[model samples]
Target: MFDITVLGCSGGTLEVGTSAYLVKSSRVAYQEILERELTDEIVAVDCGSGLAKLCEIVYDELCGEGDSMATKSLSFYTKDQVSCLEKFTSRGIKRVGMQLDTQCESTPMQVAWKLNHMVKNYLLTHPHLDHCSGLVINSPSFGAHSGKRVHGLDSTCKALGENVFNNVIWPDLTASDKGSCLQLCSMEDHVPKAINSTYTVTPFKVKHGELTSSESYASTSFVISHRVLKRSILMFGDLEADDPDTPNEGLNWKIWQHVAPMIVDGSLRTVMIECSTPNVDANQPLYGHLTPATLFQELLRLRDMVRSLNGSETLEGLEVLITHIKHENAMIPDPREVILGELTELKTLHNLEVNFTILLPGQTYTVS
Candidate 1:
């Protein structure tokens, strides 16, 4: 149903695709659906602000960060960022950007507003500061600007907390026609992509490390199910793998029961999940990430689960790809190949027979 592409694995925003959504926090990866047929239907999830900070910090080492021109006249917020909203919105004929961030800077707020104020346009999924970060994407100086017919699934606003915008964290900027357009719905209150669709999308909360461990900040993971294609993908945005039973040891359980069932339910042919470290050695705490070996463990568990669920003696040959590898670790001469080799070793376990790949930005997978 969809051609899966990996933008960046380590959950930060890396400029490796035509349309980018950097999951900028502890959960590090982004995906792009590069179907030439769906150009007008582009969708982006979360864009991490942590990426802006990291980019600037490593800019000189990577030959300098921040667009010299975009930053020249733009008012400064965080060090490396430039206002991309105004520049983007003005050019917007018919394009949609879903920002899934905790905050929307002042400048982007003004620029993001679709130019036409009176038209009652609709928002597809839910709109959060992250889901609508483009408001400040071009960095329009915040003030009263244009508004569009903004729609959200029933209770989208409630999920965000009634006064999320008015609080200290968000821009809290709304157009004059906000209330009128907000009440509109597409029949059911759930996300359009969640129910009956060619390609299915399900959003649920998962724990991931919080570099910015503020109350205002939180992260969630999503599983994309392409029914006709018989495949599923779960990306934990800044996901942490801790289990309540193992409280002191925050494993960020990558293979939780809820997620596992979903993966198994699909007639999945290929799968990709985050493995944030090269080895546990990458970070001693290992609080919010999984090692390649652990990812392998999960796949083995899932393979068996699927077999039992179907009550079939045959296994559907699960192809699991380990992703969200950090750039510094990935640069270590043939890192992905090393990870792949390890996954191959795991295939020897009984009837597991899993195929795996370590993700590098801009990597693409075609599921037949």
Candidate 2:
């Protein structure tokens, strides 16, 4: 089973919290699948904001026995903020899939800095602030011996350099210590990179609105696989689908083709997608994101793709975790309820056996 921990899954700002997820492989020897021996290794997906709440959860798990006052200060976090980061001592986490930089309001950077010993690699989906701002704020700690490796597409790395790490807005972390500390690795699309002996990550391009000349935009969807665990998880960063009538609307459909075979074969265990807004509230043109309607359409297309590929195959037992839900807007009121209701209706109408999970801060689940 793969351990999936939801740190923060809210879209945009931290009204609810931003995107951060922790994934750990419960190591099962390939030869001992029947014997069920397990080892523990962890990798974080995204490190968005919401440090206080995340710390609260960890604190409860680690220091529940003691009075709250006694455990007030546990490293960088203070009494008012919250801290139980020491819980990570149970497992080793070396890599983060998307390197989300810390925000001013929270201490995500401090948390990362405190745990730099275990953090070695950061795989970035895009250079967007909500996704990568944490890395910028914690530059001092990442320099020198505590340096961390950052991996992303060439375009993504370029965007980060020109927009985020530029000295004007933020320090150029790459130039620090003569570039010895923070190692930036540029990745190519479709090429799988080994993240360790157990994990391999493959990046695929996805359509997320228009990229104008002035915009330094680059985003991707990722497929993370564990060879020994025989499990894979698909993660979609912020994205939008082309118009139905447009000839190029098949972006996700094509991706479904690449991923459907694994889902059908039961090798892909979890699929995490962002549902940023309600159908009526999504401004696809202004901000590239997914609404419930578009998301449902994509899921239907994926189902069809699987059926066409192999009629006997089904998505049964495959877990679909919806992440990055936008905070409740005045117009939408309760976005999560509305999205869940719509998804439930669609599932009932189509009789999909797949399990659905709505990711929230501090929630953890097992993906097998």
Candidate 3:
């Protein structure tokens, strides 16, 4: 089982909520977490938003001291959706609440400070600012002394080393010397690397979009697995649909082929993917992102692949958590609602059996 906490999930247009997630094996007890006994265990999938959001969660939801900002954050969600969030969050609330009570002298910031230190490995998909700003901003607190490792593809690591952490936009923290805080580790495609004793992550390269007419931007999707249980969650970075006009158009198909067997074997059931916009004109520039219509098409491809493997065309038991909705304008309908409505219409139109949920920040989900 994996417990995933949404630190932030927006694609852009907001600073406080971007695309960060905290993932941990359910085996770690809350008491053990409070005691700070684990090492190299907590894994941060992305760090677009971090400590500040954690502080908000602790203060408003767990401590119940603030003006219910945490609850207000979910105002767009339906009551049933909010109830689901509460159900998932309730699993850890009691233990976390107990820990909060014991640390009465510690303000929310202090508690969040200590909690943030538990993350020893950061798995980055790309070097986009929205996906890594928190990692860059929060490096000073734990990186220098803790020896935290940032794992990503060679291209991703190289970009961070040369562009972001090269003493201009940020300090030179990518060195292995004692003064540096972060160590960049390059990962091989499709090879699983152990994050800790309990979890392993396999990276798959996908095409994000075009950087130039001849050059394409690359992002990644990760298969995070429980070593013993064999259960996995597939998490994707920003990506465009497989357009034949684009280079590497079929890369998403390769990912679908790779995971179809896992789905058939029942080792993978949850997929967290990005849908950056609602349905838009086909000619509109996506800038390497997905819309609900495009995302549904991709899901149909996966369903077809699963059918070819197991003669099962329906992804009935699968959970699809949509992430990274880019809020565009205040005059328009809320993008989340627009995307959700479109997805619902498509699902019903085609009788697709997947369960789709829009991810909200400050929520926790337990997937088994």
Candidate 4:
């Protein structure tokens, strides 16, 4: 089982909460959590929101702030699941039914710091500012002695090294020498790289859209699997539906084909993807993101692929955790609500049996 915490899930409009997820193995014992020995076991999928957001979450949980957004988002989890999450938060909060000292402030900061330290690796899908600003901002606090590694594709690593961490914008912390805190590692496509003893991620390249008329922007989707249980979850970065007019047209189809067998065999049932906007016009520019109509069409294609691989025609038991919805403005209705309504309509219209959930910051979800 995997415990995924939505540290942040906004596409670009929000400042504090914008596309970071902390993934931990549920196999770790409760005693280990109490002992605070989970260092190097936790991996963050992105770093758009990091230590500051984590601190905020810890403070809210400890002080009974009852942030309405968190409360509403967490309502999706059962009581038992929320109880398990309390144990995962801090040593002061034990298993279900234990009392926590809500008055203490230092304990919450300590817990937040410990949780931040547990993240030894970051598997980044791309280096967009909304996807990596937190990582860049929190580098100084990572401790020079800490051997933290940032993993990404060659283009992503190159972009970060040349543009973001070039000492002018931020400190040049991507060196491997003793003084540097971070080591930037480039990963190859389709190769499964072990992030920790418990988890391995296989990355597949996907086209994000055109950077220029001649150059296409690149993004990635990762299939993260538990080594022992063999269960996997597919997570995507910003992506658009394949357009025949683009240079990298049909690239998204490759990812669907690769994961169809895993879905059919029941080894993978959870997919965390992005739907950045509501239903837009056919000619509207997405700028490397998906609208509700485009997202549903891509999912329908996946369902067809699964049916061809196996005799099954339905995506039953599939959990689609939608991420990265852009908040355009207050003048318009909430994009999340609008997108959810459209997705529901599409699901009913096509009779696709998939469970869709909009990811929100400060929520914990367990996938088994």
- Top-lDDT candidate index: 3
* Whole-model lDDT per candidate: 0.38, 0.62, 0.78, 0.77
Off by over 4 Å in 4: 29-31, 34-36, 66-106, 244-249
Prediction RMSDs, each to the true structure: 12.5, 8.9, 3.9, 6.1
Q: Which run of 10 residues does model 2 get worst, by summed lDDT?
A: 88-97
Best by TM-score: 3
Clashes found in each candidate (C-alpha, N, C closer than 3 A): 35, 8, 0, 0
Q: Give the TM-score of candidate 1.
A: 0.50
Runs in model 1 with CA error above 4 Å? 12-42, 48-200, 209-218, 226-233, 242-266, 281-283, 310-316, 328-335, 349-351
For candidate 4, write residues 91-161 as lDDT tens digits: 21111211224555467678677667777889899999989999999998888867788888999999999
lDDT of 3 by residue, 143-205 (tens): 565768889999999999999998899988766665668788999998999977777999998
lDDT of 2 by residue, 1-368 (tens): 67666656777544434676656664532113212321124455655643444455444444333223213322112325543423221122221122222222335444333433354566677777777665566556555754466778898788878887777897776875666456667888888998766678888777666668555245788888887767788988878765567623556766787889888788886788888776674433436677767777777777778888888767766677777777644444346556776777777888876766666455555566
Could you tell me how far off, in angstroms, the CA of residue 22 lies in candidate 2 after the best superposition?
1.8
Q: Compute each candidate's TM-score over C-alphas.
A: 0.50, 0.77, 0.89, 0.87
* Model 3 lDDT, residue 229, Cα: 76
The worst-scoring run of ten residues by lDDT in candidate 3 lies at 89-98
Shift of residue 40 alpha carbon in model 4, Å:
4.5
